[model samples]
Target: MAASGISFRVAQAVGVGGALWLSGNIAALSLISIPALVRSQTEDSVPTSILSRQWKYTFEAGKSQNPPIAVATATSFCYLAWSVRAGTQLGRLVPRNSIALYCIAAILTIGIVPFTIIAMTPTNSRLIAIAEQKRDAGGSVKPNDEPVEVLMKKWMFLNGIRSFLPLLAGATALVAVLG
Candidate 1:
């Protein structure tokens, strides 16, 4: 019993910490990074080379940052799952909100990967393709498929939604802790 209690507390700490880290990262990407990137570019059709470089840099930066976020998300999900299971086993001993918190946190943390696949992956692929083409062509290849501005706008909009989910998850986890 004492061991179980200790593990539960450790899980709670890891879950909340990971959630908070993910939330901050998402918020920065949405509110600062994307916006800055958008602002740096023009609304008019820009040179393919310039846009390609920007896209490549952005994508690379995101790739670099993704591992830590992925780890945090996975860690949070694992701990939240443990808590949910443990709370369920405790039955009446666990408060309803506490159980709900575990459930909500688990769902949101796990949901991000699927959400990215469905919502963001298509655009990301398109952008990556365009970036590669531009890189290979030595900056002369302009994407005839879509305007750079349009793609960036779409990416930013979807990313805003992406950012919101983690923030909400973190907030929920914090509330769960307080409750």
Candidate 2:
């Protein structure tokens, strides 16, 4: 019935439901696998048997990373679908409230993107090398070295900006529909 234009609202509801269901499952898997990955990373300090077993499980489904990445993509789809539904629902049902919903959706979507990216990206040890270089060159290094946190905050700020464009596009579409 998806091919048929049964009703935009019905279709949207189905689509949003599917996205939410898939996202929930993916989020569960991510929550499960994340700790295992962390355990594997710290495996060296653990028993060899335990380390090997954790490492094997972590990589068993293909690569050590595929599952997480797949989950990431699924989550992204979830967010995109959620945004669509929010815009559509707001416009259709609460025309006056659409603006508020649009803004909220945009903020949430934008806020999540950077966190997702940072979670997925591997930490580059080379970044520390650069930091070290500056310190060795007699450059004044800050007493409290909080590089990772600093970078994460910056990345999140940029991600908010990154998310704004698509969200703004969605909001624009919503405004057009309302007018």
For all predicted structures, in order, the TM-scores are: 0.77, 0.32
132-164: candidate 2 lDDT, tens digit per residue: 443434444434343433433343344334434
Best-fitting candidate, measured by lDDT?
1
Per-residue lDDT value at 75 in model 2: 43
Candidate 1, overall lDDT? 0.67
Output candidate 2 Cα RMSD: 11.5
lDDT of each candidate versus the true structure: 0.67, 0.39
The top-ranked prediction according to TM-score is 1
Off by over 4 Å in 1: 1-6, 43-46, 84-93, 134-138
Write the residue-wise lDDT of candidate 1 on 1-179 in tens digits. Answer: 67766877777777777766766775576678766666666555556567756866876786677556656655665565555554355434555666677667767765667877899898888877877663454547754588666777788778778766666766777786666
